[model samples]
Target: MARWQDIEKDAPEFAERVRARFGAGIHKTIATLRKDGSPRISGSELEFEDGEVKFGMMDRSLKLLDVRRDPRIAVHSPSLDPPKEAGEWLGDAKLAGRVVEIPPAPDSPHQDAGHFRIDITEVVLTYVGNPADHLVIESWHEGTGWRRRTRE
Candidate 1:
């Protein structure tokens, strides 16, 4: 797993694109695992602070319980579509990884909520080119640096 800062250092342009989409909005989608191995979708607000991607949840929330039992998680950036006349959509960003639960530090800003740092295993971005051009999809993983593909 790599830190967000490490990714930025290694791939500046790609990291900037992904981070922009991630910061486009606060209410984003998060997928988590339930005890029965089912999937749960919830809203989350992630903070890119101190070179880490972190988030908090209400105490005893289902998502929190899910994280406690299984650390695997996936997060999606909020959608921002361009107008029909425009060709500059900001793109979609996604992050998949394990969550590391950490006790609040003595100097932590948020002490009332449960906080976790994401150990990013995969990051993906999707966007369209010109109207006549194909849609582009790019992905970065822990072992695999970056891969890209296009579709009509």
Candidate 2:
């Protein structure tokens, strides 16, 4: 797994685009594993701080419990319908990782909440190709490094 800074250092432009997409909306989606190993989708918000991806959950929330038991997590950026022109679409960003809890500071506003950071396994950004005639998928993985794929 890699830290957000590692991604940025490796691919500054791609990392910036992903961050911008995630920042485009306030509410993102997070997937956590339930006790039964089923996937649980929940609304979540995250921040890029101190070169790390961090998020919080309400105290004792189901999502929090889920992560505590199983740290694997996936986060999807907020979405908007594609424009009439596919070329105008901003596409989507996603990240999968493991959550590591951090102790809240004594005066932290989230002291009553659960604070955590992600050790990213991968980061993906999909968008329309330059001509907007094909789909472009770019990704970065911890061990494999960066790769790009396009589909007509």
Candidate 3:
């Protein structure tokens, strides 16, 4: 498992772009596993603080319940439509990891809310390439570090 700082250390530019995508908007999406082994999607927001990626859920939120039952999770940055000129598009980012629960602070407003920090397993950034004819995917994975691929 790697922290956000590890990515910054290994691939600073790529990490910066990925963080920009997440920071572009406040609302993102999160995926979790249901009790029956299916997938569930929920609205979420992420906070990058102190070299960690953290998030919170309302008390007894289904998403929080799912995480407690199964730590595996995936998060997608807020989406935006591709620009009229494909080359102008900013693309999007995604990350996969396991959540570790943290105790809420004593003076918190949402006192019983679930708080967590992710131990990232993977991070990906996908965007349209030059000439607007292909797609570029740059990804970072634990142990393997960084890799890039292109698709037509």
Off by over 4 Å in 1: 105-112
Q: What is the TM-score of each candidate against the true structure?
A: 0.91, 0.96, 0.97
Candidate of highest TM-score: 3
Q: Deviation in angstroms for 55 in model 1?
A: 0.7
After superposition, the stretches of candidate 3 with alpha carbons farther than 4 Å from their true spots are none
Could you give candidate 3's per-residue lDDT for residues 41-141 as a string of tens digits?
A: 99999899989999999989899899999999999999988878999988999999999999777888987899999999999999999989999999999
Candidate 2: lDDT of 91?
Answer: 90
How many residue pairs clash in each candidate at the backbone level? 0, 0, 0
lDDT of 2 by residue, 1-152 (tens): 89999999999999999999999999999999999999999999999999999999999899999999999999999998899888989899999999999988688887879899999999999999879999999999998877899999
Worst 10 residues of 1 by lDDT: 81-90
Tens-digit lDDT track of model 1 for 105-149:
789776766789999999999988677377888888898888888
Choose 2 or 3, whichever is better by TM-score.
Answer: 3
